[model samples]
Structures are given as structure tokens and as C-alpha cells.
Target: MLGHPWAATELGPLPTWDPAVRAATDLVLASPVPMALTLGDELLLLYNDAYAELIGDKHPAALGRPAAEVFGEVWSMPGVGDVIEHAYRTGEPFLEKEATLPIHRRADVAEQSVFTRGSCAVRDSAGRVVGVLTVAAEITQVTRQLQSLGDFAAALAGTLTLDDVARVALRYALTVFDADRVSFAVDEGGGGWRMVRRVRGELMDEADERLPPLWRRGPADWPAPAVEAARRGGASYVDDGEPLRGIAVDRHDQKVRALAAVPLRAAAVRGGITVGHHDPHSWSAADRALLAASAELIGQAAERARRFETQHGTAQLLQRSMLPEHLPDLPRLRIAARYDPGVDGNAAGGDFYDAFQLPTGELGIVLGDVAGHDVQAAARMGQVRAALRALALNDPRPDQVLAGLDRLVTSLGAEGATHELFVTVVFGVIDADRSQVTLASAGHPAPLVRRCAPDGQARATYVDVPAGAPLGLGSRPVTRTVPFHPGDTLLLFSDGVVERRQQGLDRGLATLAEAVAGAHSGDPRALCAAATAAVPGATEDDVAVLAVEHALRPSRSASMEVPAEPTAPSRVRHWLTGQLTEWQVPETVVGAAVLCTSELTTNALLHAGTAARVEIDLSPERLLVSVADSGTRGTVTRARTDTLSSRGRGLGLIEDLTDAWGTDPTVRGSTVWFEILLPAG
Candidate 1:
């Protein structure tokens, strides 16, 4: 209901009703006491019998016409529309402090006179606001008393902050006439006026800060001449804050005057004030330069701060997307990364760590910190990570591997004209064969390895990866190795973890070592989390961590049988037929394999670059037919991609005919592979 366009205000959970709703509406329209109205996007004037005698107009006939149509510019009052919306927004009855409406009294006289007005919002089911109701009286005497207050109570009701009120006033002020800039400055105490808020002259996403400085705090930071002049001035100053207060106004085209500064106060003391004036002209009290309204200007500043906080919350959410929940399996190692951005409402820094299975089934682990923060840093982090993965797959030798990355970064920076990122990266490839972890750094932190004790306490051991330069700016490739036997855990982190603003790098490393040594659990991921939690949310920068714990080599099952006859395509085909007959397999498998085997075998002989043999491992889970040749070329093109017209069906048939298929290009050659789903017998 709150989301409904017709309903105003934030949605409330329950029904809210005035105990005498209908009766109140009736009494509101009745007599000398009845100063009432109804709104339909515009106001309609009404007068009671006794009041009608004073105005000399028929009541019912005057109902439909607007006060403006009847009275012209004489009835124009700024902020009247907002006064109505405020009533709807707050769901409250309002008596405008001091406001005037010009309306006709006698049909013979044919002229509009002044009167005062009031209103309240109407609401509907679901406790949602629907419209506004009003009771406006013609109080000429009341208007004089209100001369001090200006029907502002109703106009400013829904506003919780001074900035909000100023914005409301400025909007009305701007609508009535075009202005170059509208600003609200607040008085702190003795002699300072802080420029708390301003609506951009015109909203431009790419607003440049290269122009003359816009002051945010007080006169101390203001332009030199203005600072001196404002020091001696009262609570407010118009365009004369600098010039007219101490010099002639002829220096500029904008002659400053009528630049009324209203002294704002809760009781007696001057708070601050809002000052306004036309650029090519002088200002006046009615010129919307009412400085006495500084209280509302202060309110506007608080609103801006609240808005900043909301946007800050949103940016934090966007940053969360960089962290992954699970790391892909790398045969002998378990890995995870924890990115603690540290504090809320803070900028997102460039701290990234990623570990995923490489094409070789090896775990490619990377930790790097690009300089700076926000979306740009995280996005750059992504670019470096993706490039690292691609480079590792092409050719991986720690120093050589990272050197390749340096070339990539250099090219990317040159192409994009990227800023020189003073980054450091540590790259490690955990061998799938449990041989060891090859460690390399482009000047990143040395990875920490800890042996998890039976009691959950881990003894920290830092791996010996050679020192090298960071990437981008410049770096010599460096490499080292760590034998990652089944149980050791490796920890990778960014500077945010242990590096304090004043602390030395060595002390930071030692602190990390202590934290890891104290943590229980063989899970490298858990230890990474424990160390991060120990610091709380006080980090000023970003912390990216990668924890890798190798998996114990699991025993796998294998079966083999020798058949008489040669392992030629014909013999293999016959063997499959014979095996299917024995197993009572269906005819479909019998048929699909006839062409699948013939083309596979023929291709092996014709294009398979080496003498690598053909092996078929059939099981209930799958039927794996692999002709692993020394063939480093060609891919398992899908049937859709195959115009291998006459004989090209080898791959086409595999895709159209098999469930899943792929090729694992290795150091030896590419193994174009495929899988066939086997029917349960």
C-alpha cells in the first residue's frame, strides 16, 4: 500500500483513524468557526453564510473555480503546494502559522481579498495516506500576528532536519524565479558560517571540481577576501561576504544588496542564516534571502549526511560480490579466501586473492593489492586475477609465469592508460600430483604456512618464495617452492591484516605468524577467518586472504581386461559388441558406438599426432572412450559446429551422440575427450 502512488508517506502497519473522522469534516465546513477546503491537486476557496455576507458571494457556486483563475497573480503564494504535500506526508492536521489567500467577497465588487488557510491529510485502508482535508479561515488580524512566523509550521512539519527545511524553501524559491545558486550556511558559534548544503546549480554526473573552490566548513577555508570580511560581519552575509563588507561592489557585475540576512534563533542568540540574492542584481527580505531561517538550513545539512550514509551502505553491498563462497578443487589442496573490507561506510580498497582449479587441474593461487579503493580497485583486481589464470594455463613456471603476467599488465596499462598501480602479488601453483607448491611473488607478501597441531594450535612456517619487484611499476620475476605434503596449510593475505599505519612490515608478518600459530583446526580457511576476526572491524584498508590446505591423496578404483585380436577399430568394435551381448545392453548403445568408434579410431590414425593409445573404461556411472593421441591440435567441435561433412562427424557425432565431452590439453598434447551416459542394466 505504501508503494502505491496514490498513498503518501511510508507505509504504516496498522489502521490509524481519528476517533471522530466524518463528524470532524462536517464541523470543519460549518460557520465563522468553519474556515475549510478540499484539495484536488489545487485549492478551492469556500466561505460560510456569516463569512459569505462579509465576502458577498454565493457559497456553492464558488466551489469549483481555482483562487488563481478568480484572483490572478494576487493570490500567488510560494510553498503552498508543499504545505499540502507535507500534510499528506505526515498524516497530520495543520494550521498554517501565517499565510494569505486572495479571494472574491462580493459578485458586484468583483475583486479578490486576503484570507488565511489550513489543512490536513486524508488516509485510506492499509493505514496508507490518500489525500488532504482543510479548514482555512480569513483571519486578517491573525495574519498580522503571524507576520513574525510565516505559515511555516505546516510547510516544515514533515522535515526532521534543518537541511530538509532549507531545501523545501529553496525549491519554492527557485520555482518562483530562476537563480544561479541556492545555498544554506550554518553558524557554529561565535563567528563561523559553515556552508552546509546546496542543490547543484544543475545536476551533472561529471561535475568538475576544477572550478573556484566551494567551501564546506567555515570561513577559514573560504576565499581569502571573504574570510576576512565574514570575520567582522554579523551572523550573515550575502554576495558581500568578501567585497562589500570591506570594499566597493563595482568590481563585479553582481551588485550585492537587499541581501537580507535573517538572524535565526531558538530563543535570543543568533544561530546562523540562509542568504540569497539574484546574480546580476540586488537581494531583498522577500528575495528568499531570509537569513533568519538558518535553523532550517542546518536541518538541510543533516538530511544530506543521512543520504550519504544510505549510499555508503549500498556501495558496501556492491563490494561483497568480489568474494566467492567456495574454491574449486585442486586435487591435493583445499583453499579459501576471506576479504574483510574492515570498516563500514569506508571505501573498497584493492585487496584481492583468488585460488581456483587451473586447466591442468592444478590450483592457481594469487594474492595481489592494487593501489587505491572503491569499484575501480575491485574491478582492477578482477582484471589481474583473470589475466593470471589465463597466463598460468598457457605456460606455468613460477618466475617465467609471473614475468608473462608482467608483460600482460604492462600491455593492459599501456592500452587503458591505467595509473601506475604499485601492486604486489604472490602466485603459487599447488601441483595436482602432490609434488609441491611452486611459489612466486611479484613483490607480494610471503605466504605463511602453519602445521596444525592435534590440539588445534598451528605452528607458523613461512614459505621461502624469492623476493621480486611488484607488477606494473616494474618487477623482476622470482620463484620458490614448498613441498605441500598432505596436511600443511598455507595462508595468503593482504597488508590490511597485520600492517598498521605506523607498524613496520616485519612486525606485521610476526603478528600474522602468532595469530596463525594460535589458531586451532587443520582447515586453512578457518584459520584465515580466525586471524581476520581477531582484528575486529577497525581496519582502514582492505584485507584479502587465501588459505590453502591440500587434500589427502584418495585411493581410486581401476579395472583392466585383455582381449584376443588386435586393439584396432574393428577389434575394439567387436569387443564392445561382445561385451554388450554379455551384459544384455540395449540396441541404442550398440548402434551409436558403431560410427563413434570407427571415426574415433580413424581420426586417431590420421590426425592423432602421436602413438598414445586408445583406452575404453566402461562403468555404470559413465562410458569413457578416449583416444588420447599425441594430437595437440583440433578441438571436440560440437555436432552443430561440424560440417566435417563426410568424416567430420567424429566430434559432431560425439556431441549429438554423447552426453558430455571435452579436451584436456596437457604438457604432452591435447586429449579430445567425451563421455557417454550408460543405461542402468
Candidate 2:
């Protein structure tokens, strides 16, 4: 009243002010809540200290100014200026909750504020209203905190892996708590902890998905507070770094003045999360509640992920152990196989495949599937595969092999008394002369053949072998013969490859035929890879594929396993030269073949990271050579000018000296082959 010139002009001298105005001024000054009094026609503003804080920097200067001038920026905001005007004009009191006010706290941006406020008419002793009195309680911070917790719950619900849970929890904690750093740690059960820490500067924009914040790991200097919370199975807090005194901390952690830790509420796992601030902060009840809720959500996600990882690991180990480690290597016949488990990783699949040489020098191929996806089913599949191999070794006939298998399956079913003991299989035998393939099916899907014409065109056809009842049902299998000429590929697969949840088996079979016809028909490895990927989406059942190509064994052919060593390539060169010379091959052809074979061996050892198999077939017209490796380094391609570079010179030599060259990618590794045509006699 003494400092403002407006006080003198608007309400006369301070000592001579109206009794009612004086009483109102005294009331405003005494209240703790935000309050303001607008008196007379101009609605001249008078406010207490609590109300001044709401106006920010406009406090001292707004003593006796008009309401519109004092709050010019936010006076027009809804539920503010309009509500006050209505109370003053109609003499009616107004109360509103969650009223929004766009108050300008910064020069360029307006801060949104939510408040529960009420305004009532201020009347003189004459019983006539002259102004409005407003009282407000800001709930902005509380409302925002609740909204953030909701978002955190929604985000945690979709996380399915341990890494996902850690990443999301750390990011949200750093932002929601306004902390300098956030850490998440899980007890690894052996005195070791896997911890991830994210600092404030690591936060990324919401729209950028390419580069996520850096997640640092390890047990280096674990956060002492978080570990303590996990051990106690409760929350811990300190406002002045009291708990961190005398504890081992890095230079960055030395700046933390406040810390809060919440233990994860998982029943099967032990872990906790911690948040730290650079400046001293008193955690309110709302803050503690939010932290506890967040920790609960994280705990649930982590438990689910832990269970899934355990089951998936067990299933994978069982599936791989039941299958063959390596297929039989033949001189004139090329073989490749593929196996993939179903989407449900918790159960071991019953699909199986095998190939071995018979006592009569013919090759035996078999594929089968049991009826279930469990440990029992996988065990029965192994029994069936082993029995078939033994039966085929005794007699190389396809029908006889299946007949023995049928009896064994029937006996196993009777002994075990389980429907899952029944099985479906296709057994085939390739004659030593490579003239034809004899196959027998026991209630199994028909095998496909990719026949290549002399004109270089190819087509796929399903063999019309008569089907018998599935094994264990006591039906006889009939053997059928198909002409297996050079460049023809035989594809045997389990029904899982052609069974889809959304389509019929016929459509899936047709789709597989089209995919096989379009594949490289001469390369069995490539065909196997293509056939496995023929179905687009997630498969409900496990898939197993086997492809064999007939190369027509020449009068002279040889094969050897090249070791993965520096001297392996040199040995290959020497061995190839000697073999060609012993076969009386032309000198020029021997020189070219040796050079090409050496380059391939060297490339395989360098990139494949495993032992490689090398095979060569020579006839009067051409020499066919291939290098196969079990490592996953697949096909290599180069640009037009890359042939002469040091990194690509191996391919350069092959391209220059060979009549034709290509690469075939298989399930486990790849095959690179080149052909050299000799002069006709």
C-alpha cells in the first residue's frame, strides 16, 4: 500500500481506504492458498504471497494494477477471465475442476497448468457485488505423474525378452523421475549380476528407432543401493547420499546426491531397479508409489522371459541331438537336407531325415514324421529312423525296408500303447548305375522330381507312387520306379512343409511345386534351401526336407574331405593333379582343373570356418567339380570390375578358366561348382 502510486489513486490514501477493502486485503494476506481480490469497476488486483508465486516474475509490479493488465497473457484463457467476469457480472459463484490455463512462464513457450479453482462475488456492506475473489489449487504435477505411470504399464506389457524389459524400464525411469542416471540389474544366481545402466544424455527422440540409447553392461562396480534393495527384498531410499558413503563408486556416481531403489517383485527371480539425482531431492509419497508399481510390472515381464528362454534352450538342444550330424558323401549322387522347428519353441518336434549307403552299393534315403510335438514323439522318431537304417542295410530294396519298418512300428505301438507311436515315411533307393530311383511310401506325401530336359528347361512333377496305410496300421507298401537321369533332382519332405492353417494341403503342394520348378534344378543344395523357404509365414508344425541330384558317375571320379588348415589348399592342388594324370586326362585340362580346384579350396578354408568336401567327376566331354563346406558362409557374388582385385581374384581365376560356374546355398553351408568342357575326339 505504501510503495504503489496506483494504491493512492485507486483506493485513495492507504489510511483512508474503505473498511470493506481493508478487511478483504487483511484476509488475502492471511491465507496460505493462492488467492486474489479484484475491487471496484476496474477490478484492480490485490493478492497475497501464495498467489504471487502463481504469476511468476509479475509479483511486486502487479500490486495495484488492473486484473487484465496484471494477467494480460493468461487473462483470455478459458475458465480464467470468463469465469471471473461471470462471477462479477451475475453475482453468481463459480467452481471448476481441472481448469486449463496457458500461462507464459518462458518468453517463447506457454506452460499448461491444471487447477481446481472457485470464484465468488465480493460485496460491500450495501449488499451490492463490486468484484470477484478467486482461490486455486494446482494439481498439474500429480496429474502428469499419473499419466506417466499409465504409459509405463502399457509399454511394459509388450516386452517379451530380458533385454526388452531392461531397455524400456531404464528409459522410462530416467525420464519419469528426472534423474541423472537409472540402473536395472538381475541376479545371475552365481555371485554374478547382469546390469544395464543408462545416463540422462543417452535419451533419444521418440521418433528415431534406428539408434537406441547406449546400454552399458557388466558387474563392474554394481550400484550399491540397488543391490542392497534386492537382497532385502524391499525398497531403500536416501536423500543426502548417506547410504553411499564409504561405498565404491565411479567419478560419475560421486555427483549423485539422492538415491531410490525398489526391489523387483518376481517370485522366481531376484532383481531391483535404482534411480539417482544430482541434486538433493525429497521423495514424496506419490514418487515412492510410482516407483513400486513400475518395479512390479518389470518383475512380471522378467519372469515370463526367463521361463521362455529356459524352454527354448531345452527344445533346441533336444531337436538338434535327434537329427543326423552329417549326410553321406557320394561320388555320383549329391545330397542335401534341412530341418526347422515349429513356432512353439517349448516342444521338441517329431520330424526326422537320414541318408546312408547300403551293402549293395546303392544309396538309401528316408524321411518321416510322428504325430506329436513332445519328448515322447521325438524319441519314437529316433527309434523309427534307426530301425529303417538297419533294415535298409540288410536289404537295399525300398519295399523290403518299409515292410520291416511297418512291423517294428506296429510292435512299438503295441508295447507303448500310445497313438503317437504311429509314423509316416518315404524310403527310396538309388541304384549304383544311376539309372532309376525306386521309392515306397507308407501313408506319406508323394515325393517331387525336378526333371531337366536336354534343351536346358526344367519342370517339377509329383511321383504317382501307390500309397499304403501309415506304419503300425498293417498295410503293405508297393515299390515304384522313376527314371533318374543326369540333372534330375528328387525332393522328399514331411507333410509339415505343405500343411498350412489358412489354406488347403493341395494349394500348399502346388505352391511348393512352383517354387521348386523355378529353383536351380541342377543343384540339390540350392533346391533344399528353396523348398524349406517355400512357405511364407510361421509354420504350425516342424518341416524336414531332403533333395538328391543325379550327376551320372563318369568312368573316373574321386572325392576327399579338405581339412581347415593353411596347408590344405596345397595338398588339394597336388592330389587333384595326380588324380587327373592317373586318369589319363589331357595335360591342358589337368592344368586348368588343378588351378580352379586350388582357388576353391583356399576360398572355402578362408571363409567357411569348417572342413570342406571336394569332389570331381570326369567324362569324355566335360569335367564337373564341386567344393562343399558345412559352415554358414553362403554364395559369394562380385561386381564387373571386382574380378581383378586381390579380395576377389579367386573367383576371377575360376570365371576365366571355366566354361560355366555357379554357387548353391544349402541349409547349413554352401556349394561352389565349375565345369570345364574338353575337345571332342
Candidate 3:
């Protein structure tokens, strides 16, 4: 600048400069700080090498040019222009921290730089303010890194699942690393891998319809750096020379110039996380440290989520395995049971139910709650259920069954060296003739009975069974006989079914009774569902419920499992014809019943795509037949048949032939039934 003509034109020859101008110029040029001297009324810019590098590409030309013309874009920003003007006018020094300047590195590229900048008025020999002298230190990298980490930590704190951790980690990695793509892969415990990747702000995955779209599986060997990191048990870096593989974000052969991969050091899970850049870049010490810290956080979160999932799944499987798989499908009684685990905790709670046939042709029903949530509780429940079934088989009396269970529970508590056992159970015996049910309770909630009167109105009331001291404590339980006749349904359930958090047990019981009364009384499956669903929104403890409906069974009652084949409907028709003829049913009634039942069976097999169970109950006055399938599809509603146009072609025949017909949705699938009036007695 000293020998340049432009510099000489702006401030004269170096030998002719004023004393103060020369001294100020020496001070500005020698300073290590980024200092710029804007001299005279025109405010021509002069700066040291440090300041020249800060202003990129405008150095030599900016040497003898006005500060306003050289930095017009930056000078127009809010903090830059106002602070400089204030110091120039008042001659008072000023300082600003974290001031933002939008700098253009090239014609097509722009960036925001933050700095701690200070400015003071420059004076001539006459002591009059001429221009502003500014000094600044850039702090953009440190500031942005801190801000991004704060946001990343806040986001990670709310994650409770592996998928949540992957989503959050991948999203923030893009910002922290400023990379073109980021990927998170998890080991499938086998030899496979499931990966979720985000490239250029868009997530990439394989076109798989079975998996969720955002997290579709990727090729196992696509991310070579991540796979290598996992294999090496350490972080991996690739500055260049590694070609990209796997599913590309845009085209088949997108290139990557740099990569960083970190292995997840989790105890229960093994995987790796990676970030890739499309342009060549070097990984600095600070960049490697940040990536390792992020990987640590992800590993810890993944371990926590996997532990929870493993415990929860194991507990649920153990509890369900202890309970009955298939209930007794009887001719005189219809039985159904349901069990729902609590919403909180991973331990298995003490709720169980079972229905089995006794040696004397009677049915034994039991529901119990042993007091806690843990493996011990589930084990204790299994003991109680097994003991009760044994006692009922030996005596076939409700009160005697409870007495034997009391002894067994007392012995169990004695065997439990650390904690005493507390159990409440309701044991009932349904007579072989379906005339009545004898119930005995050991400090358990009374069983409920829903009765349909001659007027066809159903009412639900709790059976007045005697309550005694809970098992493990000494007390005698008395038996109460309730008239569980035809069209009357009995419900036995654990306290979880009628005890809610923040609500009284009485209110929950009343709500259950109302739900039972409103449900169809003839279908035990529907009754059990309604009773369990009476209290909404995630029960705090496990729920176990059993429903038994006493159907009017005369001399002729039969059941058959319908196969999913073309011959199923014809076989059902032939079987029904023989059964009705043997029972002395009239030809007209038998013909109509056979035709309607065949159509119902065909619908179940065609639409449900599963095996169907057909049950028939014949009385002197009417014949009732039903077809139930385990599939959830093909449910029929009355509105569907309100008009012939909307009714299914097969169901229209059922509606025309039967005296009364309807459909009841069950816990597993659905049941469609029709009643045919027999000839006059």
C-alpha cells in the first residue's frame, strides 16, 4: 500500500504524510488484533493483514476505497451501522458482543459470522474526529456449537424408546456436523441390521410395505464406515478415497467425500452412528470429540430402552403362559375370559382366571388376585389356580374348595420366608343341570348375575355370597346358592375389574353392573368384554374376568368346528338335518334352519378366512344356532341390513327365514346367530 498509486492518491506520498496520520497508520498496521482504520471525511479503509483476511476477497481494492463503499452490505446491518455511527458522532468508545454480520464468501455462498467487536473515533493532529477505528474477534463456531448442543440435550431427555432416540440423534447430527447425510443403524440381535438415514434433509429407506415408511430397513453393507466402526469397536474417520455404497438418497451412485462413524458402546445393544459429507473435508479434534460425546448419549439411551422392552415382554409372556389357553366349550354353558395387563411397570401383576370341568359333570369357575406385581406374585397366582382346580375335583363343593385353598395358601405363606402371602378368590360351581350356581368367597368381591326376566328386560345384581377372612388367615367361608337358571349370566372378576385409581370400589362396581345389563346376556364373550371395558383409560393393576351364560339345553345340543373348505357348508347342512330329525323337529322348521345356518357358515369361512365354531341349542319352543369365527373381519351390523340394497346377498336369506337374527361382536372375532320358532307343542 505504501508504494501503490491508489494509496498515494488517497493519503499522499509516504514521505509527505502528517505526523499523527503516520503514527496512527503504524499503530493500526502493527496490531495483532483485527483492526481497521477509516481515515478522513471520505472514510477510506486501511487495515492490517488480520483484518484483510476477515473481509475476504476485498483486500487490495478495499485499501484506498471508502469504508461505506467497501462494506456497504455489512454496514447496513442493525448493530454494525448504529454502533459505528454513535462512536463517530460522540467520540466515545463502544463494544458489542456476539454481533452478527452476514458475510458473502463468494458470489453464490453466504454465511453468518458472530464477533465481539469494539469501535473508537479516530482523530487528526487538530484533535477533531475524522473516522472510526474498529477491532473485532470472531466467535461464530464456539457460539453455534454450544447452542446446538443445548437443543440436542433438551430433545434427547424426552426420548423413551429406541426409535425416538434414533430420530432425535439423526436430526441433530445434521446440524452439529453440517453434513450432507446422517444414518443410525441398530443390530437386529441376529446378523441383520435396521437403519434409518437422513440425506440432505430427507429420510431414505427401502420400499418395504411391511415396515414403517420412515424407518424402513436398509442394506446391511451400505454404510461402510459405520459397519467398520462396529467391527473395530472404535470410532472411524475417512477424509477421502472411500466410495459410497447402499441405497442412495437421489440416484444410484451418489458420492461421499468424507465420513465419521462412532460405535454404540451399549451393554445390551450393538450398532453404529455416522455422518457423511458430499464435499471433501477434514475432521478436527473438536469435531471428533463432539461426535464421540453424541454417540455416548445415544448408547446410554438405547441400553435403557432395550432393558425396559425385554423385561416388559418377558413379564407379559410369563403371566399369559400361566393362565388357561382355551376355555371349556360346553353345551349347557357358554364361557369366555379376558386378561389385560396394567399400563405401568414391567413386573407381572397377580391376576388370573380359569374355567374347567369337574369330575361330576359340573363346571368350576375361579378368579383371584394375590397382592403384588412381580415374578413371585405370578408364581403364587399359578399355585392358587392349580390348587383350587385340584380341590374342586376332589370334593365338587364350593365351600369345601375354599377351605382346602385356605390351608394351601397358609402353607404357602409359611413357605415364603421373606413375605406373607395374601390372596382373595371367588370359587363357584355350576350344577350339571344348569339350575343354580353355588359361590363361596374368601374376602373376595361378590360375583354378579345378570337375569333376563319373562318381560325380556335384563337386570344385573350382585350375588349375596358370604365373605370370610382372606386366605392365609384362619376363617370359615360359607357357600351361597344363586339361581343361575336359563338366560342368567354369572360374572366373576378380580378387584382390578371394579377398583379404579381415585375412585371408590362401589362406583366401579355400579358402572360394571350397568355395562353388563346393557350387553347381550346370552353371549358370555360379549359380557366379559363389557365388564372389562366398564372402567376406561389404563387400569393401574392387571384385570382378570370370567363370564358364564346358562343357555337352555334340552336333549339335543351339539357343536362343530367348520373348516375353511368348499365342503364345509354342505357338511353343516347335512349334519343339521340329521340332528333335527333325531330330535323330532318338523320338516319345515328343520329345512329353514339348515338353509340359514349353511349361509351363515359360508359367510364366516369366506370373509373371516379362519376356522368357525357352530353351536346349536334346541328347546321345545325354539331352536337357536350361532357361528363364531376367530378372525376380526366380516362383522355385521343391523344398519347394514336395514335396506335390502345394503344387506349382503347371503344374509338376506337369513333375515327372511329366521324369526329373530342379530350379530354380537366378541373379544376375539364376532358371532352371528338366528332363532327359529319350532312347531306348536
Predicted structure with the largest lDDT when compared to the true one: 2
Off-target runs (Cα >4 Å) in candidate 1 are 1-319, 322-325, 329-332, 342-346, 416-419, 452-457, 534-537, 552-681
Per-residue lDDT of candidate 3, residues 299-372 (tens digit): 88778767766776566557767888778878778787777666553458788888999888889999989888
- TM-scores, all candidates, are 0.38, 0.64, 0.60
The regions of model 2 sitting more than 4 angstroms off are 1-164, 167-182, 197-228, 236-260, 275-284, 329-336, 411-422, 430-436, 450-459, 466-468, 483-489, 517-529, 548-681
Per candidate, the number of residue pairs that clash is: 22, 0, 0
Per-model CA lDDT versus the true structure: 0.54, 0.78, 0.77
Residue 395 lDDT (model 1): 76
**lDDT at position 344, candidate 2:** 56
- Pull out the clashing pairs in model 2: none
Indicate whether candidate 1 or candidate 3 has the larger TM-score: 3
Model 2 accuracy (lDDT, Cα): 0.78
Give the best candidate by TM-score: 2
